[model samples]
Target chain A: MLDSEVPQEGNSTLAGHKKAVYARGGDGKMHLVQSAGWEVEEIVTRQAVDDLLRMTEDARRRVEAGQTSALEYHMHRVRMDIPLLAQASGIWQWRIRRHFRPAVFARLSPRLLGRYAEAMGLTVDQLQKTE
Target chain B: MMAFQHSQASHCESGVMASMLRHHGLPLSEPMTFGLASALSFAYLPIVKINGLPLVGYRMPPKFIIKGLQKPLGLKMRFETFRQPAAGVARLNELLDAGQVVGLQTSVFWLPYLPADLRFHFNAHNVLAFGRDRASGDYLLSDPVAETPVSCAPADLQRARFAKGVLAPKGLLYYPVGKPQTPDWQKVLPAAIKKTTRIMLDAPLPIIGVRGIRRLAKAIERLDAKNDAARTKLFIGQVVRMQEEIGTGGGGFRFIYASFLQEAAELLARPALNELAEQLIDIGDEWREFALLTARQIRDRDPLAPAALADKLRLIAEREHGFFHALRRAA
Candidate 1:
């Protein structure tokens, strides 16, 4: 039977979050036991979040400098890669890459822009804005 | 509507499956549900990148739990994924009006109740929506990963359900379509165990199962001072993320599998499975040790050679390879 003592490492720390672990109860059935947060898990999650924010910040700078379109920035903000963005928007991979360019993105038809916007959960106007 | 009892689970898919089955009057523990589904596996795909790092998975892709349960247990389930968000929301409300608790696939990053640090682009997170308070526009959610039942704003839940990314939820929803017949554990248990063992031991691709572990170890071993520190750290971080953060239960689902084996031992009347379970636990501990060492190296900004890290990983790979091989023979 699995022990009730939760492993000290790599546990999540979301408020009131308990892990349903297995333990041998008095009835000899493997019952679910609740376990609290582990410090290691919290640290790993925090690090991942930090990495994502850093990527988003970099994308924001690129958009500000006119190196990429607002769509590209929003993609990074949502932790998406080019292929994933393309798949989600139902756009061809190469077409999505071209759309990353600000000039090309600006000239996209309303119908095309709508697909990208909806995929990102944003309006067309919001997709056009870097902020 | 069935009164859903929310139990925090170590992993999302298995937890949701267990809870849903129980509500339908099939009282299967999370590990039993996981084992019966044959949900455990390992894959390290170098070509598939997530966040600029190679993808490493400790379990099968999403929806396998739902799919795997069908034949063995004779469960009838309905699953749908929407192209239009509005239609998806309408369908969900329609189901709610009929007093059915619905299972939804959503992106973790878009779920408001998650800590900012725990939020990511993962879109395969599963939750059960039991009811909605019309006045507050908050849906009562039974998120297996959460400590307790939580309330989600309609807008927030909508965004989560339709979040765009790899493995996008696309407003996916599923539920039981009919009552499950009594399962034939005698037939189901052995079949599930054999399939899992075969998949882990005999996958054709080198990037899956025991081969994948070795492949990952070799990749880590190949890292050198020639590689930039940032690149090395990113790779290590991704491994850690796959192993620890992606809901593999503690120790990359090792403990959960051990629990399953312990249970299986009783069910099959095979005490040898209990011995194997303890061995699996030891392998899990080694994985934890590896994570701890890697984390320390990264945090301390230690200038240790990649060879040292590679050595540690190789040891883990060897142990895992041995354990799975023995498990195959024992089964």
Candidate 2:
């Protein structure tokens, strides 16, 4: 891409930061241009962030209705899912999913709760209850 | 102690490797390293899901570049990882004390210096640890994506290096084990160019290379969003995110590859490759256009937008198919 053609439209997703891109200069050689941001980039990034928010909201509703445990709500609230929480905590996915049942989660041992809390960077108290 | 010079580049892994190599007296441009590794390609693996979204990558998997450059360039270097965090940290400090800039694989999420919005659970992000600040005990790092070098606390660096997840680093540390040798550009460039085209054009599965782009287009068109609006948006978002985000440098690495092509042409004294580089630039522009269209569609929420998005991808697939075929011959 030509240096002049590079987009410099700033966006919020980049948090007022710029990144390097290789663009053609007047000398017909490649040079690094600090691009403010691109709207397309912002759109996709916001979509990801917003999708997280959507999941969090849905989890909140499910927890409120008692269809699932606080585990579901707090998981997305901390920006994690079954795979991430499992990986970070070294817990099995099926066990994590099993805990989604309110009864099973309520009866969970303190040891497992400690593991989840550590993985999510939350306290054991915070793990048991939703904010 | 030798000073480690820091330079910004379009991508992280290759940039980190380039800086580390340059510090070791093997001054290589980021594009040169990336091209020599033949790291560029397209893959859409529906089977591999992240956050419930399918995987879409514009390049080969992580570690491909730093490792891929080995055989072709005769870059004999030490690549080691520690099972224990203490051992890894100790070795890193030892290397830094010896004036070695060490390349590290760390999770982007734990790096506090990055803007919070850009921090995610990506575990394969690369950075260079040049030294440690005596006063603060923070590791001085050169994150190529950032405009300037930054510092990270020892604890935070450990946390990032040991972040447990998919593609966990396991404290990966690598540096040049032997002095680098200059490659014969005439022979190496042609081979690299041929390998890249083969990667783009040859894949057993439809979900790889040019075929992968076509599969992605078909998936977009097949998305049934009548009642699942949010999920539909997520799918589209996932597709665009892979190309735009994750430090692709622009047009999902097309621009970077084009730059490499331009350099390769001059290196190999192949004037025809210069024209091919321009051709690739045009193709990269189309990719940008595709991103623009997809983003606008997400905002507009038109019922028929998926078809439009798919049509754009189809065009990109055709263009890439033609470009790779021509590039193979031109190089």
True contacts kept of each: 0.44, 0.68
Lowest summed lDDT over 10 consecutive residues: which window, candidate 1 chain B? Answer: B297-306
Off by over 4 Å in 2: A60-69, A101-107, A125-131, B301-304
Q: Give the per-residue lDDT of model 2 (tens digit) for B70-103.
A: 8777887677898899999999999988887789
lDDT of 2 by residue, A1-131 (tens): 78987779887878877889878888877667888888888888888887778888998899889889988888898678888888888899999999999999999999999999888767899888877
Which residue runs does candidate 1 get wrong by more than 4 Å? A1-36, A61-72, A89-118, A122-131, B301-304
State which candidate has the highest DockQ.
Answer: 2
Per-prediction CA RMSD (Å): 3.3, 2.0
lDDT of 1 by residue, B81-200 (tens): 898889999999889889888899999877888876667778889999988988997999999877789999998999899877677788999999888766777788878877888778
Q: Candidate 1 clashing pairs?
A: A10-A41
lDDT, candidate 1, equals: 0.79
